[model samples]
Target: MLPWIQLATAKVPGGGELRLMRRGEEFSIRLDANELMNSRLGGSEEALATLACQKLAGRPRPRVLVGGLGMGFTLRAALKVFGTDATIEVAELVPEVIDWGRGEMAGLYGDSLTDPRVSILQRDVGELIRAGAGRYDAILLDVDNGPEGLSRPANDQLYDSRGLSDARAALRGGGVLAVWSSGPDDSFTKRLRRSDFVVNEVPVRAVGKRTGSRHWIWLAVKT
Candidate 1:
């Protein structure tokens, strides 16, 4: 068996640590001791984007904001659905992850970073939402666990009432806010509705097969 190699490491904003490991061609992101994200047979990012786009049909030349760039799967999927003139701003707090994607995982992403349509911001998504008011046509958040913080405590703020409010405020009129989660979040759906968003919960198969692990995506449209 090939030995697992430590590709890179970074300290989380809130005392925890995140580490990336590579075993041959596969990579995984671990928070503390447990695996937080895996780039293997865990699930399908394409399916997630398909569900979100279906919920956001008829929007053209949309300005998109992606909260996280995990493995560049969601970003690639979004680019496929949006037009060439569309802009996608992806905010990732960990700089090392970006560096790793550029150097080690470049083959997986295929120059997505260099794409003119994408603007990579090395900042917190919460701060970005707070500063960007009524700007984006769509905001796709695939940060840490669904409505639960695992890697960073600050992530909890993104799911809270104030954070959801800020996210809604950042979207243009009738814009969609698509949130990816590992599982269903009932209370979070309620909070999204309370924020005045037309909400829909979508369930996607983990591997895009007929039967697999289930993941949830919440599509909330700003009214």
Candidate 2:
């Protein structure tokens, strides 16, 4: 077995640092000692896009906003489902993660970043959500471990009451807000309902199969 090699490090906005690591062909993004995401475990991330894209499949020229660019899995999955007429806006707070996708992990990202339908924003996704009104056909958030903050404290706002309301307002009618979580949060589901979204909690595997740990994806459609 090969030892993990540290590729690069980046500072998180609110606090803490992110370390990108590579072991053989596998890549991982870590916060302190905890692994945030891995190249191999992209099942739920892909599901995040697939489930949301399924909702917008009939729309002509769908506009989507992805809250995180973790290894570009979500973006790539979305690009696969969306046609050339679709537009995808990826907002990643950590710039180095974007760099990793284009640099060390370029093979993992492939041409997804260069795809004409995709746009990269090196800023907080929350800011983008707050700044827009009925702007997107769907919003996919995989920023933190769950509704609770893990890497950055400020990320908590993205799942809070006001934040969810802002996200609701940012979407076009019937737009879906799909969120990835390490586990389930009953309160978050309740909050989603209170914000006038039709919420669905889906249990997905970490690697798409039934082998790994179960993760959750919250599909909240604006009502």
Candidate 3:
């Protein structure tokens, strides 16, 4: 059996450390002691873009904002599902995560990061949402452990009432707000409703073969 090797490390802007690990063919990005994302298990993350794109079918030249690039699963899936006419803006607070995608996990990302329609912003996604107004057809948050902010304390702001309100204002009419999470959050669902989004919570498998821990995805369409 091959042991996991630490590939590299980086600092999260506010506070915290991210470690990139590789074990044979698999890879993982961990924040402190908690594993943030893994190369092999992206089922739920991919679904975040797919489910949201479904709701946006037939929309021309759709513009999408993806928070937290992770391993680029959601970004890649968005390209495939949203077609060539769409443009994607991926906001990743940690620059090294983007580097890992293009460096250590280059094969996993392929050309998604270089695609003409995609722009990788090394900015806090929350800031982008606050500045955007009627600018996106979809806002996908593959963020820090959902609303609980396991990776960084500041991530909690992305799911708070003000954050939800800002996100709501950023979207165009009939836009979708897709969020990826390790599990369900009842309170978050209530907050989504209060933000005036028509929400649907979905359960998905981590391994993609319909086998693994049940991960949740919230597809909330702006109303």
Candidate 4:
């Protein structure tokens, strides 16, 4: 078995400490005792961000809120899609994850955090959603493993009925809420529909190129 070491850092929401655990060569971000993100097999993080940006088309100054910085793939993808006038607010719970990207994962991120349009928030996605007050044109969520909540127990709330409702209220009219899941989630689709979002399920290849494991994205638009 690969050894895992807990990293020391700042405190997190719900009153606890943040840490990073290493399993073999891979790393995972954790809030207190809950795992927030695992880098080894989590490609949906990047996929959701890329697909959301792609769906935005040619919007000149789109405002987007991304939940979970992870490896910075989502933020980097958003930068590619939107121009200088655009603004991106990234809400990440753990500060260590941000540090990791600023340090170890610098090559992958390449100063996307330093982009003038990007704002990093060391806060919960739920708080950001509730506080948005229908300001964002797009909300890209890549926080959980799906509706199943594999990474953390608290994340389950983010995929539940109330959470979906909050997400709907957070978006402007006609805005899109893009969620990245590891696999298919029919119940989540039903939940989205019940929340008054016109839901679209999209399948994307893991690699940006053609041919790879199929991942799913749920794009729910406020109507």
Cα displacement (angstroms), candidate 2, residue 158, comes to 0.8
> Once superposed on the true structure, which residue ranges of model 3 sit more than 4 Å away at CA?
none
lDDT of each: 0.83, 0.91, 0.92, 0.78
Record all residue pairs in model 3 with backbone atoms less than 3 Å apart, i.e. clashing.
none
1-223, model 3: which lDDT tens digit per residue?
9999999999997778999999999999998998988888898899899999999877999999999999988999999999889999999988888899889999989999999999999999999999999999999999889887887889999999999999999999999999998999999999999999999999999888578788999999987
Tell how far residue 64 is off in model 3, in angstroms: 0.3
Give me the overall lDDT of model 4. 0.78
Per-residue accuracy of model 4 over 32-91 as CA lDDT, tens digit each: 567655665445556676667666666678899998887776787788777778899999
RMSD of each: 1.6, 0.9, 0.9, 3.5
Worst 10 residues of 1 by lDDT: 41-50
Q: Which residue segments of model 2 deviate by more than 4 Å?
A: none
Model 2 C-alpha lDDT versus the unseen true structure = 0.91
Candidate 2 structure quality by residue, lDDT tens digits, 113-208: 999898999988999999999999999999889898898888999999999999999999989999999999999999999999999999999886
Which pairs of residues collide in candidate 4? none
Q: After superposition, how far is residue 88 of candidate 2 from its true place, in Å?
A: 0.3
